[model samples]
Target: MPVTPDRWNDLERLFGPRGACSGCWCMWYRIKRSEWSSNANAGNRRAFKQIVDSGGTPGLLAYVHDQPSGWVSVAPREDFSSLERSNVLKRVDDKPVWSIVCFFVSKEHRRQGLSQALLEAAVKYAAEHGATLVEGYPVDRLEGKKFSSVEAFPGSVASFRRAGFREAARRSPTRPIMRRRVRPRPKG
Candidate 1:
């Protein structure tokens, strides 16, 4: 389900006290770096809550046995200011798109293909919201090399691939801009 006001506590529980990474509260891509650094924990939490309270569906939540187990931040490309400013993750074209910026799964839920499932749900969510194309910036994992979970927060290229996304651009060796076209839900 989308992260609405009533589901705030479930999201908080899923993210834990660290806000899913040093107080990110999933607001890292939504705000400027300096602001994110300053806000960190409590401020970020409140800021995110305001988004939810205002009825903005910043992302979707996944549940396991009725417990919130994962999150994926998907919104209009314009919603993430940091992406427009990133050297490696800059837009691929003028075409409008919805970007998948982050993913977090509870420790116990890791390696269970939850990330791939979340990506699929994100694409569906975006399509339902009138998106013709969905994009993701996933980290390309090298063979025989392991990276920390923090580094993999954006998600893996393989996961995106499994969700039917293809590489649209690759400015960085380890970061690939992936895209998937979605037919918007028919009007009622």
Candidate 2:
């Protein structure tokens, strides 16, 4: 399930004063570049608050020791226009897709595989919510190459693979679109 008001403080603490891993506050995929850069701090906070206050959950939050530890932005693909505009990440089909856009883990929570757990939770969330398909655009780095948590916000191919998501298409060598089917069984 997505984060709610009760979980906001945990999120704030998890992200700390920097706001969810380097002042992003998880705003990269939702807003345009100019706007995002300009409103990096205040605007992002306002946007996140608006989503929750309006009874909408932009993504799920992970808690460790009863404290917010991580976050991932997941929702209907169409909800994020910035994605469609990107040359790298665009619609592959007219069929609706639930997209897992970004991931952010608290500094203290890094390297604990929290991302993989959040991803698995997303699969279940989509399944429960009647999503026929869930998709993600994860980075595909060269073999043996490594990326920091921030660099892998979109997630790594290996992470999505662990979540039972398979490659559906690859528009760019470094970007592979991964997907998982969560549809309920059809009536016989």
Candidate 3:
């Protein structure tokens, strides 16, 4: 479900005290390198909390039997500061798009199709929230190589393909910018 204020505790519980990846708190793309380096984990956690507290729906959390099991960061492209600066992920078109920047599945939930589910959920989230295009950066993989958990946060090309996102651009050998057009719900 959308990460609202009431759901903040659920998110915190899912991320744990370490803030999911040694203090990333899912803010790697939201803040600058200087601020991120100086503030680190605590700072990023606070920043993310503030976004939630202020009624910003930064992403969605997936639940398994009512237990928060996964997370996917999906918001407008403009919300990701780091993405705007990356040449490898530069915009492929002038059309506005929502970006999927991160995914975090609990250790127990890994390798169980949670990431693909999250991508589908993200597309629905973006469409319902007024986005017509949803984009993601996924690793296409190298011959006979596997991505460690940390290296796969943005998702895998296979997952994106399974989620119906096609490659829009591939600036790097492994990194492909994938996109899917979303049809918003009809208004009453």
Candidate 4:
């Protein structure tokens, strides 16, 4: 389900007091670094809530047994200014695309293929909204190597692959830009 005003409580419960990582509130890419630093915690939470309350579907919420389990931030590429500023993650092309920038799954829900499911759902959600292409920047891990959950918050390359996304660019050793084409929903 998309994060809306009615589901604000569920989102808050899932993010907890820390705001899903040191007060990030999943606003890291939506604002400038200086602004994000100043808005950490309560400020960030309030800002995110404003987006939800204003009827913005900033992301999707995954539910498990009627409880919020995970979140994936997907939006038009322009919505994330930070991406345009990052040399490493800059636009792969001029083509319009929806970007998947973040993911957070409850500890208990980790490693259960929830991330992949969220990726798939996000693609469908974007397509429904008229996006023909969806992109993701996921961490590429070497075989048999392990990393902290925080490092995987953007997602793992394996998960993107499982979702039928193909590598579109690799400007960094461990970060790869992946893409998937979707047939947008037909208009009436």
Candidate 5:
């Protein structure tokens, strides 16, 4: 199961003291740029915590046994302004979609396919939540070189493909808006 209220601690532990890369606490996409900068470390954490307290589940957490190993933020595409407002990431159509906005895994848990696991869960989340379509804006990974953690928040193209999403549009050279239509399973 995905992380719930009682498992909030796992999410906190995964973020660590620095708020999972320079005090972002994964709020980089949620808040306005100026506000994000001003709030810094503690600010983002508070913002994310408030969202959780209000029972607005922003994403899913992966645990290896008991500890939080990774996180992925998936919600209605419009919920992430940083992407919605971006010239590079414009809407493909008027169709509504749930967006997989970000991913964060503890340094110790990096490269363990947790991002993929979280994405799989995200698809399920979207499908169960009445989203007929799930979308993602992911980066194309080059061989050998690694991107800054901040830059990698959108996840890699390979990961999205691995989770059964296909490219819907590619306007940017390095970024692509991929999508998967989550058809409801037939109930007997």
Candidate 6:
């Protein structure tokens, strides 16, 4: 579900003090490279906290029997400044899109399909928030090659495909821009 202030503790617990892999705190795309490098760890933590404190849910969190299990970073494409400046993940079209930028699954929850579930939730959340399209930048794993945890954070192409996203473009052989159209849930 969409993360809120009430769930901050759960997220923090899932990310730990180092902020999920060297203090990224999932701020790699939200801030400039220099800023991210300097603001890593504590600075990134505070930045992410401000977003949650202000009632801005930057993404959705998945739970396994009430315990936070995984996360998928989804927000307006424009929200990720790094993507806009990315030569490999440049805009595919003028269509406004909600971007699914990152994923973090707990060690115990790895390979349990939580990433896919998180992605599904992200698309639904975006649709409800008035997004017509959802976009993702995923790494295409080479045949027979293994992907390390850090190398797969953006997500794998198969995961996006399973979530019903299609390859929209690929500037680099290993990176593909995928997208899926979304329909908002009808109001009761």
How close to the true structure is residue 144 of candidate 3, measured as C-alpha lDDT?
100
lDDT of 3 by residue, 2-76 (tens): 999999999999999889887899999888878887878899999999999998989999999999999999999
Between 1 and 2, whose lDDT is larger?
A: 1
* CA RMSD of each candidate after superposition: 1.3, 2.9, 1.4, 1.5, 2.2, 1.2
lDDT to native, each model: 0.93, 0.82, 0.91, 0.92, 0.84, 0.90
Per-residue lDDT of candidate 5, residues 18-95 (tens digit): 887889877887878999999989888898888888788888888787777888888887777787677778788999
lDDT tens per residue, model 6, 1-188: 77799999999999988887789988998889999988869999999999889988899888899999899999999889988788998798899999999999999999988888888888888888899999999999988999998899999999999999999999998999999998867422
lDDT of 4: 0.92
Candidate 4 per-residue lDDT, tens place, 1-188, comes to 88999999999999999999989998999999999999879999998999898888999999999999999999999988999898879999999999999999999999898888889889999999999999999999987889888888899998899899999999998998999999999533
> Model 1: per-residue lDDT, tens digit, 137-184?
999988888989899999998889888999999999999999999999
As for model 3, its CA RMSD to the true structure in angstroms is: 1.4
Q: Which residue pairs collide in model 5, if any?
A: none
**Model 5 Cα RMSD, Å?**
2.2
Order the candidates by lDDT, highest first — what do you get? 1, 4, 3, 6, 5, 2
Q: In model 4, where is the ten-residue run with the lowest total lDDT?
A: 179-188
Clashes of 2: 0
lDDT measured at residue 177 in model 1 versus the true structure, 0 to 100: 97
Structure candidate 4, residue pairs in collision = none
User: Candidate 4's error at 83, in angstroms?
Assistant: 0.3
lDDT of candidate 2 over 65-131, digit per residue (tens)? 7777888888888778898888778887888889998888877788899999999887777667668
Please tell me which model should have the higher TM-score, number 2 or number 4: 4
